[model samples]
Target: MKSKSNKSICKICGSDFARSGMTRHIKSCLGKHFKAKTKGKAKRLYYLHIYAFYNPDYFLHILISENARLEDLDNFLRDIWVECCGHMSSFMRPGQHQEIGMKNKINEIFEPGLTFSYMYDFGDTTELSIKNIEIFNGAIKSKKKIQLISRNSPPLVACDECNKNMAEIICAQCQWDGTGWLCKKCAKNHECGDEMFLPVVNSPRTGVCGYTGD
Candidate 1:
């Protein structure tokens, strides 16, 4: 998965950036190119950069208000990226065993350079890497507890069968070896049969459990 190239669109500018460069891109854009009405009352919000753990291509850029709780972030993630079957999920320090409570206030735990791990659906295990990148004001004039500022563009994979065309389906049984991407046409002729197939969705949870897409 690391070898795959990935990119995301910056909603503010409508320009695309490579995964490796998104952090720098957003940091600069948020201040120079885009401005938020952070006036009114004094407010601080945490800018979190989140992405799939080992599979970094799938990612999200969020601006969470200081008053927001961990639960707010968890719900936002589930709504957009990984909530399949309502399985339990948690956030923890990257190398730790303890889980952070959903009720914990963002202002209490968030700090620049802090990176954490998020696991969704323990059984299928779609893990994500979350990091508090920066603290900013106003939150783009949003009232919501958390805002999804940006997300990675849908990754395109070539069909393993014909070696051309974007893959739209995966053979779940064959995904373990990372060799089951299939285009619409090739998916019909997969030797594993149609029952083992799963649609290739945008989220990192694609092909896992009963996930189809959001």
Candidate 2:
């Protein structure tokens, strides 16, 4: 009986069968072509940021798709930094080359948005290959520190009367004590009082008359 399935026969091989049989046969017959079209020929375009120099020298590459092999990365890097051929290194996308296994080859076919990288340890020149590879962002980020400059600790002046202690008091009449070191009563009497006593200029007296200039 006719299976009446959609698969009729292998068009290329010319074998007769049902619709399902024909479909399966066709797939088997063109397995290589399908694999090539889907895996090898298929390409995806992507953008890659390359850090070439020991410093932060970034180069941008736009491609229709990534090549499966890392060798492609080596060639691309060499072209970018022609001056440094063998010095450059290569890494793949999605994972850092250094972190991944070394034996992995880069020339394999790649899917879209795939990424790769190359580096130079600043070594001798040689025709570059997919050797030791490492990948890192060109810039490293860290928190910033703020520094405060103190105001010279406001010049600790000694007390004029009690030279043993720090002084912030100033004798108004003489202006000798810029910091105003006199006691509360002395400051009031010297500056506010009309009975100004000889301008508090003379050496500080031990008694009230001397300190307050009474």
Per-model C-alpha RMSD? 2.0, 34.4
Candidate 1, overall lDDT? 0.83
The regions of model 1 sitting more than 4 angstroms off are 1-6, 33-37
Error of 1 at 211 (Å): 0.9
What are the clash counts of all predictions, listed in order? 1, 28
- Model 2 per-residue lDDT at 51: 32
lDDT of 2 by residue, 1-214 (tens): 0001122333334555442243234345444332344433333322233332332211222221222234444454444343222343434445445533334443243333444444433353222222112221111112111111110112233454445554434554444334345443444545434443223221112111224222
Off by over 4 Å in 2: 1-42, 53-57, 82-85, 92-117, 121-214
Models 1 onward score TM values of: 0.92, 0.26
Write the residue-wise lDDT of candidate 1 on 109-202 in tens digits.
8899989899998888999999999887764455688767789888878887787788888899887776788889988877899889988888
What lDDT would each prediction earn against the true structure? Answer: 0.83, 0.32
Clashing pairs in 1: 38-138
